[model samples]
Target: MSAAEVSVRRRRGSFGRLFASEVHLVFGRRRNQVGLLVLFGLVTMLGVALKVSAMRHPGDRGGDLFSLVAGNGVFLGFAGLTIEIALFLPLAVSVLAGDAVAGEANLGTLRYLLVAPVGRGRLLVVKACALGVGALTGAVLVALAGVLVGVLLFGAGPLITLSGSQIGLGDGLLRLLLAALYVAVGLAALGMIGLFISTLTEQPIAATVATAMVSTLLWILDAVPQLDWLHPWLLVDRWSAFIDLLRDPVFTDRMVTGLWVDIAYGAVFLFAAWLRFRVKDITS
Candidate 1:
């Protein structure tokens, strides 16, 4: 074989190795899988309750099945991503991100990987990206399950928002897609916070639990009436701002501001994580 052919094969193998490692590390995780199962069960229970209620109240009025599933309930059930992220996504992201370095550090395998000539920053980047992907996956699964449950309980039809605006079937579907993408962005910051917390402790549980507690407590504080002044700046409070999509006029002003706030937080959290990472010493 020519020398060029051998080099080409070597690079291909490296890429595959990296990709496979990420997949295995994510899916092989017992916590990730268990968390998903629990979410699915919750959705099933909610769907059954909805179905029973609808049967009991035939006099109720609202949009058709399609609209009910994809539109009204999705928005009204802001819990779709909003409440889920507050109560659960953080826990899932924390488990993965919290273990990113600390898990390896605890097991003594991080040292060998570092000695393989890879830069610390590069390793951190790969690990962070992997954890973020895991988090996004969990969020999407919950969204899909919730939408499905909502549809079965209600009928499918055009979606009507509280703003009195109507979105056609196609538009509603696309909006759902956008909503999913936005959710990933929101969770990405939390993942970084977890990653940063992980670097400070050798115990994986400490980092994971701390990230969930800190984010949730701050989110509650942002909701407190007396703390209205701090709402705009709170990382968790801004996520619900996407509900502007449901507005009749689709308020671009507030939407744009909310998005920018999310971007700013993403930047701030990532920078903070990286800063701590650069200073952390794993050589010990």
Candidate 2:
């Protein structure tokens, strides 16, 4: 074979190897498989429930169609969707993300990877990409599930906003997409938190629990009106402010602020993970 062809083949082989590694790192195991199944089940359940509700309420008017999902789900009276997402989405993030680095550390693979000459920063970046994709995909799935069930059950009609205003159904959907974007961004931060914790310990459960706890605690704190000073800084506080995405007279400004805040936190956690990973002694 010509040298040029051999070189091309070698490069292609290397790319394939890396791609395989990433896949193995993601879903080549039972836990991840179970996770995928569970997530899908949740989507189906929520979708069916929303569809049923729409069927039951058929002609109800002047309510937020977007509220049917928290990008995950919840059964609430006023804004149960927010409650449902608040509880479940974090759990999902915790489960998938908590194991990210810690799982490698526990299995003694992190040391193996570090010793192989791969840059720590690059590894972190790759892992972050995987987790980011997972989070975004999950968010979009839940949103789409809700929208699908909603549309199917209710038939085509004006989309009622949270503010009790009506909008063209298509425009309402665009707002939902915007909400999914911010919510996805926020959830990615949760993934980074899990990754950061993973770097600190080899116990995936501990790291995952810590990620969930931190999120829950912040949310609790944010709920207290007395903690006004810290509220704006709490990612927990504004988690559902993305609901503004579907409001009439549209509140894009606040949504943009929330997006930036989430993006900033995601960057910080990923940076911390990279730095800590470099110094981490993966050999247990």
Candidate 3:
């Protein structure tokens, strides 16, 4: 191969190695492993509870699937997603993202890693990819566990929507996956926020708490009765809007808005982090 071709191939290989190393570092820890196990366990418990509840109230199938169990097996994914989007999944992501940089610096590994043959920008990119992978994995695990348990316990059938519309099993499963994707995207933005905070301190725990506290505060502000003006622009304002996908006609305005909001946040925060880390004085 020509020199140019060889250069491109080498770059690709280097990035692949970087990404693999980053993923290993992020998830190889005991705490991260336990966190993932806890997430799956909680979702599993939720599925069992929903199955029992459905059996107890066979004639009480009501409410939208996204917000309630609705006594239907197919809707169980939405039920689990509803809980995860608000807390569990995001918390898992925050723990990883918050430690991406600060944890390495605290352990006195950041300086050594920088001494390797990788650029700072590329290092940040690999870290972001690792965080995204973790967030997406957490999301898919909840959905998959919910679906598996939901089908086994309650049995799968047509999905009933909020508008009293029935969706076929195939289409229902597809929509469920889309809803999970939406949750993953929203959590990715939160991961960026954690990454940004990680750049500001050497204490991973502090960064994690700060990220979670900021997210909780945003949720609180979104709920205030008089924060109407800020509601439209808040990061968590449209997280649950993924439920619109379940509509017969598919109301996508909110989902579209939510995606753009996530994109904007991801861009702004990731850039800020890169800028900070690029000039940071690593004394550790």
Candidate 4:
């Protein structure tokens, strides 16, 4: 068509290429692959253990959510997610987000990337989006692996809700997907915080550790009885809100609050990352 239209198409193509390259850089690394494998392995092991426990003690119950796993395979996914959101999932996010900027700088490639035609803001956005993709991928994999293992070991059917109600397989699977998405949103918000930390340091390891510590610290603060007043504001406070999805009526209040909290955290930290990177000198 017109010259302007051609230029617009070219720009879109360039951005798509850049984003694809970033995704490759994040997932193509051997370490990231191993991290994902570890996550899957852990979830699978949990499912197997639950199966053995059910065989040994058919009448015994484990815990609130876990107790349902032996009877209905769908609960394994929920239980796996609960265990993951406590630490493993956030650690996965930290690894990717912390390396988004600091890893490139450590390799002395940050300056070279800046020399290209791409603006710093655009590059940062691409990096953030890539981190989000990585986070979602990890969360979804855990849930899926849990479901597969649980179904094979225990068999799938209707899910027993916490309120002594039952839901069909279709509706239960849908809730599992929603729980995975909810957890992914929280991990994405944590990734943004890691992105901001990555902007401040050249050591990717340090950034990774620091970002993980932020989550751990929040969890510790949230666990304190005296801090109950401040619990509502902590990023990690409502991480387990996905459990509400298993209820009969499906409690939306906590999940909605958690979603907004995640959004606010993501917006604030992403802006901080942008503002810092906008002015920082590229010495590498």
Q: Which candidate gets the maximum lDDT versus the true structure?
A: 4
Stretches of candidate 4 off by over 4 Å are none
State model 2's lDDT.
0.68
Model 3 regions lying over 4 Å from their true place = 64-70
Evaluate all candidate structures by whole-model CA lDDT and list the values in order: 0.69, 0.68, 0.84, 0.91
RMSD of each: 4.0, 4.9, 1.7, 1.2
Deviation of model 1 at 69, angstroms: 5.0
Task: Say which prediction, candidate 1 or candidate 4, comes out ahead on TM-score.
Answer: 4
Which pairs of residues collide in candidate 1?
A: 65-155, 65-156, 66-155, 66-156, 66-157, 67-157
Task: Please provide, for model 4 over 151-249, each residue's C-alpha lDDT reduced to its tens digit, 9 standing for 90 to 100.
Answer: 988899999888778899999999999999999999999999999999999999999999999999999999999989999999989989989998999
**Which candidate, 1 or 2, would have the higher lDDT against the true structure?**
1
- Would you list the rank order by lDDT, best first? 4, 3, 1, 2
What RMSD value applies to candidate 2? 4.9
What total of clashing residue pairs does each candidate reach? 6, 2, 0, 0
- Give the poorly placed runs of model 1, Cα more than 4 Å off: 1-20, 61-79
Worst 10 residues of 2 by lDDT: 71-80
Q: For candidate 4, what is the lDDT? A: 0.91
TM-score-better candidate, 2 vs 4: 4
- Candidate 1 lDDT over 164-217, as tens digits, reads 668775666566655656667677777777888878877788888898887888
TM-score of each: 0.83, 0.80, 0.94, 0.97
Q: Given candidate 2, what's the lDDT at residue 51?
A: 58
